[model samples]
Target: MDDFRLFTSIRYDPELLKVPSLGFTNVGWNSKSSPFHMLDFHRDRMLRAAIYWDWTAAIASISGQEGLENLERFLQGATKDLVNGPHRLMITLARDGSLGYEISSLPATHLNNLYPEYLPNQSFDSDSNISVTVRGGKVPIKDPMYDIFVDSQRTTKSEFTHYKTTFRDMYNDARNRAKVNPGDKKEVLLLNEDGYIMEGSISTPYFWRNGKWVTPPVPRKFDAFQGSGGNDGTTRRWALERHLAAEETVLADSLVDGEECWISNGLRGFICGKVKLH
Candidate 1:
């Protein structure tokens, strides 16, 4: 059962990450109506992976209106015990449609402060119907940065590299190989056998190239012998949707030492950082 469950982690905050195209906002912690970063995008990504893996029951658990309602209910119940603050909400679904979640507090990020042009304004319509009882608080103001490292070894691309799941042995092994010291604020970027930079172990990599933010292209078709591309991360999707970043093939050799770049995940939005190539 553990091996069959699909999962995703998302940012749950009282402050909304607005989505004007949706015409309605998603419920967030403590807000009567708001957004959960890129909730729909995350759901769609998981749904696609489920379809690819032929997990019919898992697909049904996260697919349409019913699934959305069920997810809201689960989140509402799970967040009842939470305190007023932003959180990292990790949700998992079983093959039998059972849902589980874990909530952890997160320090505020400088996403809006660092990239104001890319972030949407915090606006919500009073007519929004979605509501939840989760607690809310101010977004943290402490800006944290990370040190990025290029892995010395190349990883073979596979379904695990392209999808977000519990099957994380490859990623774990990559991190282990890096031998990072405890409490190190760093991420190890993995490369493919063909020398294409894939992604960070737990975040999406965005390089500043030709006067624009460019991320490694994620290939739709998986070729065992070719690069599997990187995971289609929600943060990357958000950046691409807003034209804040472009998708291009990034070669490991192209990375410049101490060059400014960015990395992101569902928990943290766009983060400014620098690269360290081996």
Candidate 2:
């Protein structure tokens, strides 16, 4: 299956998850170049994971500016035919540094509309120079508000959990233990043995505490039994850089029922979510 390949799901969109601090101009539909969200961060993350796993070939494949450009070109060519999209780009890397990808159309989520503060100025020319035939299909429906739950089981933190790769058995197991249905608009949060919240099955988890947003802290290094951390997600990194959220140890038992909070990932930005403790 595709899960055997090391991968990352990137949101290739004309608009979505765009912030002014990223220092990009003519983003979204106005982009004359490839419109990949947080491309640098994603590249760096994969490199770091490859280094950790000692995947030398993978490291060399995505090492620097040249690598970034190569990746951008690949994405552009892959989506050149799409007339309109906010598609999810599933990029996979093999041990030999060979690349594989799959593109799927995505519906507009409430991300940009609900979090306008994170959006870039949209006063650019309306006549976008990008020319691609729009695929014929019914307009995709907006994603529903997600139902977030805390898993009863504790997960052991390791390199797999720290990196965004295809080895997602830990996450998949957590979801299964919680009996999460495939079509359910739900995310199950994982906790470590120390009782600190790690992250969600497929997204980073955040909480509102003391009037501030706090996510679980991820340690730089951890021994087999010592490090109980979460993935350093792209959205999580962006939030930390902008001070939109802070890193603090969040105990799993501290979460309250029906509390409002947020969750984020590369494909989906900060999503308005509600806690459902069981």
Candidate 3:
């Protein structure tokens, strides 16, 4: 789960973001060759999602450019029938108003190019022995990794928290901590200074507590808690809109009072597993 560079950035390619001329449409796929494929028109959805999170400032600041053009370019290259496959698209923005993005599929096989021994082994398979670790206390990153984790929820927070910048120090640190325990894939559940369960390292945490499902509140003020800003993911939005979940502060002490818990991200919807807090 340690984050590392997967693909090098391409200088600038508009053609890479174009939709295929004869491929999947909103109604259905162009070909029946891939029967199990699903078509999701994500370009517009992605742009709207970014704007909702107020992350389009950098793109807007650019001269004669709309914020969504780059995302269109990023999705244009995903013409393959592997829509159901575990692929990840990353959009990174620099502090200097520079933007970079990459779209790539997760390798079918596990490959550890860096930090091979930094964390315990975890199965890539989704359903196998999934769990999450509750941070025993306020865990802050040291020296070089300090900025990797967002210590504040304010607009001035780390770029990683607001946008998926090229920073994975917080996630990597969480994975390392999870390795101390045993599970197929143990994520780190970060808590705020008030001991409220905020989010997982790479996911938004949800719980069924007090007869309703709720997600941790989005941090709006400066808090010493690291990893405060949860990604404004599509799944989170869906759950909120459909009345499936409400935004509320989930205290760590109330975790045991929940009926069940799960984590979600844009790439992967609700994970079908629970976090064992022992």
Instruction: Identify the leading candidate in terms of lDDT.
Output: 2
- For lDDT, candidate 2 versus 3, the one ahead is 2
Off by over 4 Å in 2: 1-4, 16-33, 110-144, 220-227
RMSD of each: 8.5, 8.7, 12.9
Using all chains and alpha carbons, the TM-scores for the candidates as numbered come to 0.80, 0.79, 0.53
Error of 2 at 267 (Å): 0.6
Expressed as tens digits, the lDDT of each residue in 88-145 for candidate 2 is 8998877778778899887665434222233111121122221111232111112355
* Candidate with the larger TM-score of 1 and 3: 1
Reference-based lDDT, each prediction: 0.67, 0.69, 0.41
What ranges in model 1 sit over 4 Å off?
1-4, 17-32, 111-116, 119-142, 181-183, 220-228
Instruction: List, residue by residue over 149-249, the lDDT tens digit for candidate 3.
Output: 22222122343443343456665566566552322344566655456665676666666655666787653322335444554444455456546578887
lDDT of 3: 0.41
Q: Candidate 2: how large is its RMSD?
A: 8.7
10 residues in a row with least lDDT, candidate 2? 119-128
In candidate 2, list every pair of residues with a backbone clash. 14-28
